[model samples]
Target chain A: MDLLIQIIFGLLTALIIGAAMMVVTVRNIIHAALWLIASFFGVAALYLLLEAEFIAVVQVLVYIGAISILILFAIMLTRHISGEGERLLTRHWWAAAVVALGLFGAVLLPTLAGNAWGIPLPTGPAGTPEPLSGVEELGRGFVSEFLLHFEVAGVLLTVALIGAIVIAFEERSRRRRVLTLAEEHTLNQRQKASAERAAAAADMAD
Target chain B: MRDVIEQIINTTFGWGWPGWAISLIGYLIVAAILFLIAPFQMLFLTLFERRAIARMQDRVGPNRVGPEGAWQPLADGVKIFTKEDIVPDSADRWVHLIAPCVVVAPTMFMFAVVPWGPGMVPVDMNIGLLFFFAISSVSAVGLMMAGWASNNKFALIGAMRAVAQMVSYEIPAVLSLLSIVLITGSLSLVDLIAYQGGLFISSSDVAGVPDLGLGWFIFTPVGFLAFIAFFIAALAEGERTPFDIPEADSEIVAGYMTEYSGMKFGLFYLAQYVLNFLLCAITSVIFFGGWQGPGVGWLYAQAITPANPGGGWIFNVLAGALGVFYFLAKTYGFFFVMVWIRGAYPRLRIDQLMDFGWKFLIPLTLVNIFGATIWVALTKWGAAEGLAIVEGWSPMLRWAVAFVVTLALNLGAYLFLARIFAESQAERLRVDDEVLERLTNVA
Candidate 1:
């Protein structure tokens, strides 16, 4: 059983690394996003191997299900810019490589020496693991022991939501499209006149 | 099925067969069965939808193809298979080729956690409900792939709308299910069903209750709201009428599937019906009890399991048949409702779809979660159970209080949210008209 698990883990790790590499190296932006989903799926598989089924499902739910699709949507929406045969990487490829490698070393060096690198199952698969008792434990942990952190995170997300709405929200009037060139010209003129009026009002008040 | 197979293997063969091997064989059988079931369901549903909708329209459906269009889907399969598989010259050929498979694969994965009868689940995953929804969401990416890769304007537009509609409606779907999860306190589909075993009241809410298999969540206020929200969201997810903006046939020319022909189109059609079937099944599982009906609980209790080996094989057959019958009845009933709605309602516009999902359903489900919490507290919590206020109340009284409170709360939330949604929508349209009038210099 141990050997079987190790084999699966190794395969998943290989998939993760390969997909991550492809995510950066792939020329097609959409393909890169798809590779990112593969990498996310590999991580989810690892979480399942750890018997953290809830986390594994969440990883897939949030990453492959939601985030990857969002990324794909963003990429597809900008298909005019991210057209085929375009170079995704910038000119400073070496700089990015150096930073990436440096970060990898900084993170990987300690992980290679630590207990996490080559550990057997901490507990044999005998008793029902508490975390795997379904979503209740996750909820309890969030609401009780990690209550402070949970509230902080909730507040943080709320702030982010409000911030996103503020930043991304467009004025209602601007969404309407003028049909003819004359109508468009008139709308622009009206906008300029309003801008001038507001400027003048500000100057007079000052 | 796995247990029966393993038992046969253990008895017939020596104990030499490894545990993993037996398990693998069992899973393989389940997968083969599920794959077969998906296509079969697709075939049945296509005919079912056509016949039901046709009847609603005062017309006799396709009865020519082998006894009431029973074999129509087979004819469709042959036709689609023989049709030339055309890929547009400008299309991303690889993505186009893989998109149908991608769409179909998740629907297949969905069968893993669905419980058809007692002990009929392929996988009893701890987070089964989460797994089901998560796997379902993966298909949205495939739909986007179909749209983006097709290189056709209609296809891309269809794909974009598909993804947008899916992602938006998913919020309400999950939120509504979350309320049920909060009440049941379990994400497992079987657990959810087991919780609904009393006569007209959940067994979990009232102790020592007889398991008559009549207790369904839909009878409760929380469940009713959830059922409404979820079915609507399911409509959006399955791209049924009223939420079929993504694939509005008249508008976008088959939407994301425009570029595909032959088995590829057949695959999308198969994926769709399979998804609809699963969604309907899950809706029944969550709101209407999936396999739980009159006598099902009692029958299953007497069925032959390891704990109840004295029970007869006859009981097993009876229980399994009854459970599956109830499950299929509820599921097909939902599908019939889908057909009914399709016949009754016109498709929603894309903007209207988004507005309904985000503005109305999301808020309603969110409020329903609060209602669920209140119900749980009132019914389950006590002084002995760490509550001060409900210390003296009897269990029956507490249940009644919870029911009344939640009913009032849910009704208020629904009416409040509906009014706000309608007003906001009207306001939004008014703004749109104002802007349009200014720009066009015409009414």
Candidate 2:
């Protein structure tokens, strides 16, 4: 079982890294978004391998489902649909590389230096015989131990949502809403009727 | 399944098969069965929808292929297989080729978590409900890929509308299910079914209730509202008519499927019908009693389950047969309702569809969730949880009060929302008419 898990983990790690590379290297923005989604899926699979099924499913649900689609929509609406002839890099590429490398090392060095590289899995408290990360336990902890944090995060998200709507909202007087088919028909009919009435008055005067 | 395989190999044959080997064989067999079942269900659903819709339109469907057109899908399949697969000249070759598989694969994966009968789930993951929705959403990415790869404006528009509709409706769909989850307090599909084993009131909600296998969640007001919202959302998700704006034939020719032909188009068709079938199956399972009809509970109790290994194997077959029968009947019944709806209602315009989903269904489901919480408190909580008012009441009485309160609350909310929504729509039309009059006068 351990061998199988390790093999799977190794494959997933490679997939994640490959997909992440593709996300940056891919010329087409849509293809890059697709690659990013693949990377997200790989990370979700890693979460599953760690027995964090809830988190794994949420990662798929929120990131791949919502965020990736949003990104695709943004790309499609804002940029060229085919995404051809796009430049891959700018003049400051070396600066970006330096910053990226620095961040990666900052994240990696502490774990590499402070802890043993290889270790067996930790067991739960004696006699429990199960992991303490069940969905029910997580829910209880959220409401009890992490209630304040959860609420604050929720409030922050709500604020962001409202801010977005406010930014998007247009005043009724200033907005140029498109006419529906029915409204257009009514306008056309009224124009035709008034034209006929004006022609009739001219005939009577003649 | 592993237990049955192990029993046969190790106990009966004295082969002493390894545990992992048994598990591997079991999963493989189950997977093979599900794969077979998914496509067959898709084939039958296509024929079923055609025939039912034809009957609604006062015409007989294609009955010449086989008895009542049973083999029509097979005939169609042969035609699709023989046709030339067409990809637009400017289309992305790889993405176009891979799009159909991406769309179809998630629907096949969804079969893993659905409970066909008692003790008859594939994985039975603790996060089965979440797993189902998460996997379903992955197909949206496939849809976007298909639209983008085709290099066609209509396909792109169709895909955009499809993704937008799916993302919007999913909120109401998941929120409605969240209420059920709140009430049942479990994400496992099997646990959800098990909770619905009583008379009108679920035994889980009220103790000492009779096990008639009729305590479907739809009996409760919250469940009814959720069922309506979820089923509507499901229609949007499945692209069923009236909500099939993505592929509205009058507007866009086959939507994202415009450039697809031959087996690729057939694959899209298969995925769609299969998704529709799964949606109906889930609706029946969650709102109606899935595999939970009279005689099923009794027979399953006597079956050769792990809890009762000494029981007769014949009871296992009988129970499974009866359970599957009930489940399919409810599912097919829902599918018929889907067809009926397609025949009755005109397709909604895009803006109207969005307005209905975001304004009507989402709010309705949200209120249903609150009602669900109240039902839980009334039926389950006690003085220890600060529900001192309901502490002295009997379970049945409490159940009745909860039912009445929730019913009133839900019904009131529905009527109020409907009026407000109608008035708002009318007001918007009036404003449009006023603007049109002013513009016409000036012209």
Candidate 3:
């Protein structure tokens, strides 16, 4: 049973790492996003294995459902750059590789090698089994223990949303600027042609 | 079924087999059941949609293929199977291939938490509702992948519209369910259905009420509003007509499905109908008293089980049959409504869909949530539970007060939001006319 458990864990770990590698390596941006989703699913499965059903579902909901779709949306909305023969790597690829290796060595090596490595929650008596929590504990914690943090996070999200709106409306304000250009600028024949182009752009914006 | 499977496996194998092996067998059995049910559900839903829509359109739909055209979907399935599975030359081959699997998988996973009859859940998950919706959302990626991989402009557009519509509408749908969740204090669909086992007033709301199986959430004003919002959102989620901008046939040439052919297209069709069936089933479960109609509770109580092995197996079969009958009746009724709406209404534009979802439905559901809170306070809470005023009131009186308060709030919110939406739309059009007139005059 223990060996079987270990085998499942090893498989999930391999899946996660392999998928993550594919996410980075896939030349097609859409394919890369899909690979990233596989990584997310692997992480979610890991969470499920750890008895965090709520977190696992949330992970899938947010990452696979929303984030991955958003990435694909972004890929589609932008210029079609994911076709064959286009190099995915930058000129500083080797530098990135070296940095990644160094970072992994610096962070992962010590922690992985350390004795007291796992998450340290409040432990009960030596033989007493720990209780696994789901939505109930999380909800209670959000309302009671972590109430301020929860509210703060919510407020932060609201502010961020407002900030996004303001930034988006800033572009709308530019359309008004284009409308006012005719009143503000004095034009020669050459300048008039440029002004007409501006007018046409504004009209198109409308 | 899972528990039964486990018991059977354990009994046959004696004590030698470990718990995990039994559990694995149980899981496989449950998964197999769900997987099997999904395709059949898809088949029936497709045939049902066609026939139902045909009747709505005043046509005798598909009377040829075996007994009121029950075998129509089967025939269609065979045809789809035989057809050549075509991938566009420009398509990203792998994503195109895997998209159908990804799309189909979530709908299958959703069946895990869906209680078909009493003690008939594949997995009675604690956070079943959340798990179901979250799993459902994962399919958006599949839809997007299909669109993007197709390398067709129409497909991409369709995919974008579908994803946006789904994500936007999910807020109202989820928010509407929040009130129910708060009311019941449980996200389990089984528990939710179990809560509604009494006459008019739920057993959860008023203890000792006879389980007439009439206490549906839709009977309450808050739940009614939530039901309205949820059904609309469900329509959007299922991509039924009026919210079917994702695959508006005339506009985008079959939308994201333009490039897909044969079994690949068939897979999408299967996924869609199955999804619609689940949505309708869930709606009935959450809002209507699913599998909780007359005689079900009593039969279930007398049925053979771990608690009462001496109880007759006769009651078990009777209970199962009656429960499933009621559940399917309610579910099919909702599906008929979907078909009715599809026949009645034309598809909305993408912008209109967004506006309906974000502007109207979201605010309505949000206010309904507030009303739901108020309802919870009046119906559930007392001085003991921290609401001091409603302490000494009778359950009936409290229920009445909750009904009045929530009704007023929800009705007022609906009117106000409708006014606001109308005014904003009118205002935008007015400004557009003014701007247009000014531009034309200047030219």
Q: What TM-score does each of the candidates earn?
A: 0.91, 0.95, 0.91
For residues B1-443, what per-residue lDDT tens digits would candidate 3 score against the true structure? 54566566667755656777778887887788778888898888888888888888889999898988878888999999999988999998988999899998899888889998988887789999999899999889889989888989999889999999888988999999999998988889989998998898887887878888889999999999999999999999999998889898887898888999999999899899999999999999999988989899899899987888888889999999999999999999999899999999987867678888889999999999899899889988878878899988988889989999999999999999999999998986686556544554454
Candidate 2: segments with Cα more than 4 A from true spot: A80-83, A102-129, A170-182, A198-206, B11-17
Considering only the true interface residues, what is the Cα RMSD of candidate 3 after superposition? Answer: 7.3
Q: What are the interface RMSDs of all the models?
A: 5.5, 1.4, 7.3
TM-score for candidate 1, residues paired by index:
0.91
**Which number leads on DockQ?**
2
Evaluate all candidate structures by whole-model CA lDDT and list the values in order: 0.87, 0.92, 0.87
Q: State the local distance difference test value for candidate 1.
A: 0.87
- Candidate 2, residues B64-89: lDDT per residue as tens digits? 99798899999999999999988899
- Per model, the share of native interface contacts recovered reads 0.69, 0.82, 0.69
List all candidate RMSDs to the true structure.
6.4, 2.4, 6.4
Better of 2 and 3 by lDDT: 2
True lDDT of residue A120, candidate 2: 47
Write candidate 1's Cα lDDT for B171-252 as tens digits.
Answer: 9999999999989998899999989888788888988777788789998899999999999999999999988887888878
> Which residue ranges in model 1 land beyond 4 Å of their true spot?
A83-87, A102-133, A176-206, B384-386
A-chain TM-score of every model: 0.70, 0.81, 0.71
Q: State the weakest 10-residue window (summed lDDT) of model 3 chain B.
A: B434-443
Candidate 3 TM-score to native: 0.91
- lDDT (C-alpha) at residue B321 in model 2: 91
Scanning candidate 2 chain B in windows of ten residues, the lowest lDDT window is: B428-437
